[model samples]
Target: MAAAARLFRDAADPDSVKMADIAQAAGAGKGTVFRHFSDRTGLLKALVVEETRQLREQVLHGPPPLGPGAPAEERLPALLSALLDLKLNQRALMLALERAGAGSPYLNPTYDLWHSEVAGMLSGVHGDAAADYLAHALLAAVRGDLVEHLTGQGADPDELHEGLRRLCGSVLAHRADGTV
Candidate 1:
């Protein structure tokens, strides 16, 4: 899988990454690759699924801000930043997953988990109703296409991170603090 991932990462076009390429890179036969993965889609999905699991584990178990211990105010921005980095870093493989018929990202366990966590956290800062909408909005902000589009148009990631920081600060602020 390492060879396949490397080839996918380096390929000019994902469609060009054949089993033979992966097999050669892995010092195995094409049959060996197919035996393990079934086909291209299987291999790609495995890569993407592994990434999702790792992200989920980190947020659920890793220390502070990203994990369980920090206040919602601190965790929310850290969560968004971490998700943004994941989307950006995994852009190519993620796009491939969509093309491989993984279907809507919204329906995936990863999305559901993130959405639930975000909404749960937001409920502490905002009320339940506002938190639901705000959580969806926050997740939307870090989506792959928008991130790609913004960065393609010269938006630096640091700028994006700061924008998220300011947005979260505003949303998570108390009602009497002029949040509305």
Candidate 2:
């Protein structure tokens, strides 16, 4: 698994990754890789699931700013930032998984987790309806492809983070007239 991870991370093109490559990199037979992972998509999904578990742990039990100790205002942006980091790191694997599934990303359980969390936070600051819509919109803004596109066009990390901060603020803010 470690060898497969290294190969995936170092690959110039994720679409070119194959079970044979993973098997050779792991110093094992092709049958061994197949027996463990079934296929390329399965192997890539395993990698993503492993990475997601750590993020879940941080949100579920890790310290403040990201966990439970911070206010909603602080936590919402923090959560988005953490998610952006994850998407940034796993862009290749995620892209492979999406291609293999060839379905709506909304159907993915990870999207549900993020949507639920963001909606909950937004609900506290705004209303239920706006929260629901804004949560999905905000998640869209930080999508892997969008981030990749922005960076490829020369936007820096700080610029992206700042954009996220402003986005969260606008979504969470109430109108000056005391209305949504």
Residue 85, candidate 2: Cα error in Å is 1.8
Candidate 2, which ten residues in sequence have the lowest lDDT sum?
Answer: 96-105
User: On residues 1-180, what C-alpha lDDT tens digit does candidate 2 reach at each position?
Assistant: 777677666765667778888889889999988888877766776776677887877776888778867777798899998888876777666556666764345666677888988888877666788788888999988777787789889988888888998888876677434676
lDDT of 1: 0.80
Look at candidate 2 and give me any clashing residue pairs: none
The CA lDDT of each predicted structure is: 0.80, 0.77
**Residue 129 alpha-carbon offset, candidate 1, angstroms:** 4.6
Full-model lDDT, candidate 2: 0.77
Residue-level lDDT of model 1, residues 10-81, one tens digit each, is 765556777898899999999988999888777876776777777788789988888888888899999999
